[model samples]
Target: MSRRAAASILVLTVVVATAIGACSTAPLDVGSSDTSPTSVPLPDGPRTARLPSADPIPVSPTPTPQLPVTVTTADNRRVTITDVSRIVALDRYGTYGTAVFALGLGRNLVGRDIATKFPAAASIPVVTTGGTDANAEAIIALRPTVVLTDASLPSANVLTGQLTAAGIPVVTGSAGRTVAGTDAQLRAVATALGIPAAGDALVARTDSQIAAARAMVPRDADRPRIAFVYARGTGLLILGGPGSGADSLIDTVGGQDAGTAAGLTDAFTSLTSEGLIKSRPDVLLMMTDGLASVGGVDGLEKIPGVSETPAGRDRRIIDMDDGELLSFGARTGDVAVALARTLFGRP
Candidate 1:
């Protein structure tokens, strides 16, 4: 599809949008493949997926960006950036902000989104609010020279409009929630910042790390059935389907996607007990915060369809930090490694 059309879609849906900027176009072509859920045996021991520690993902040595960079943004606009004094990378997953840090330009960030929760950026002023939209006045106060963001935010248009009105250069792009898409995301951010070499270096490091993590999964082991669930109290209970990004992680960790296997066609669906039971997920994957919102493990089993499934019966739940688990950025390899260890390793 044309970039113009894609941009329109990007402005609408954060997760299902397939829009991308000119900086890195090819990587978005890789699509998520669905796997049918099967009644496979699990490791039977560990019931949760936890990282060894909460340390932020490591970064590569910083690189200098050759300035006066011109980029054809995802919204089909050519924006030339000459200053990098104050930058704010905003998005739903903090992918762009993380990329800037990986490129060694973290020091230039003037403001950050809620999802950019790394220690290095802990002190940066937050510009996003209400979990989904950004605060225009807060960003205006920072007077950022350029803002790197994408269609991941539901109010991306309004946010961009307000920023543009204030004369801040906003280059829109997408960090698709897929393993391959992460490569393009890093490259796209570097392109926007006039740091192609750094992007390449970061991508290389990410690739090697991901390969090592992938190697940890035993080829002969049985494929586990994983269902990605989004829970927010008793009000919102969504299931991950095709293009949800969870399916990619599930497959990467050597598991089949239960929602996809159960014929969920959309990226997200209002979860129903019958639908979940039909999928028969061996493991229920959730965001740490999302799990807690519903009152933790005990609360999750009490959900309508949860108690009838194998995952609920066995208390098989694997949760990661909401901000990091689906960020789909530089730390994907590390995330994969931790998940693999939990699903298959010894206590």
Candidate 2:
């Protein structure tokens, strides 16, 4: 069998394993009794609701198209594009597609990765499944003139080679999870789509929004020490230390990462019950699916050592959609602000 087939089988195996594990665990009714905090009080004052960062940035009335453009990708590969039509972005975080939409070229998207669920882009035909696995045949069927992706795509080189052989320009951008990394990704996608100026404008707007959100965080507020736990029923992964998108999000919202404080250095690691208890996180951050998989806050508390932590005892958990939580793309600033509001109350 080909490497592509092998990779697909491997991913399928992992997905099946996770599903089996979930089946063995007790199911939580989707509409079961709610234990999570329903309404966090807003700060005492009238404050304007900030616009969502995902909103399109206003560009020139007539966007100047730069064709036959050559640009260097995050992988240091130089690729030239002759056409800006029929684009596909297969990045796991769907940042490229978001950048394209932000650049006012959403209509040109012929296909999207599974993670691209934002407005306009959400309706595009998905060319990948199981998060980042590219369906080569499906992608080819889309007849995308250019493809933008990240290094995380399974069998990236093989996929890119296949597309290149078929006369499509495949450009890979940085998958950095930090703010600066996000900026670089936006610029890279823009350059690949031949709209460097639009990228610059979007980045500036994003940075400004981030700054505004940061300003809303109360200086005197009690910033919670937080831990982001990735759970799929019995399968649990702890997002710890620096470099992880969870760390970036926690920092952006003015919260401390308890995992980092406990000296866990990798992007993700299995946590011991004792280690988790000792970390002493005041709040737990989780993806919505992960939270549901463990039967919500009640089920999460049943995990060893979790109930002992201040977070579990108080049931202080913040959950976001798995994709949006980590995408770190155009909506990152808005996400940070939303998370901040949840933690310290809205302003």
> What's each prediction's TM-score?
0.83, 0.80
Candidate closest to the true structure, highest TM-score: 1
Candidate 2, 55-114: lDDT as tens digits: 444443345668888988767878999898888887766667766776788778899877
Q: Which pairs of residues collide in model 2?
A: none
The list of candidate 1 runs beyond 4 A from truth reads 1-41, 45-48, 51-58
Worst 10 residues of 2 by lDDT: 15-24
Cα error, residue 43 of model 2, in Å, equals 11
Q: Whole-model Cα lDDT per candidate? A: 0.73, 0.67
lDDT of 1 by residue, 54-121 (tens): 43443545567688899988888788888888998888776777777767888898898778876788
Cα-based lDDT at residue 295, candidate 1: 94
lDDT of 2: 0.67
RMSD of every candidate to native, in Å, equals 9.0, 11.8
**Residue 289 lDDT in model 2?**
72
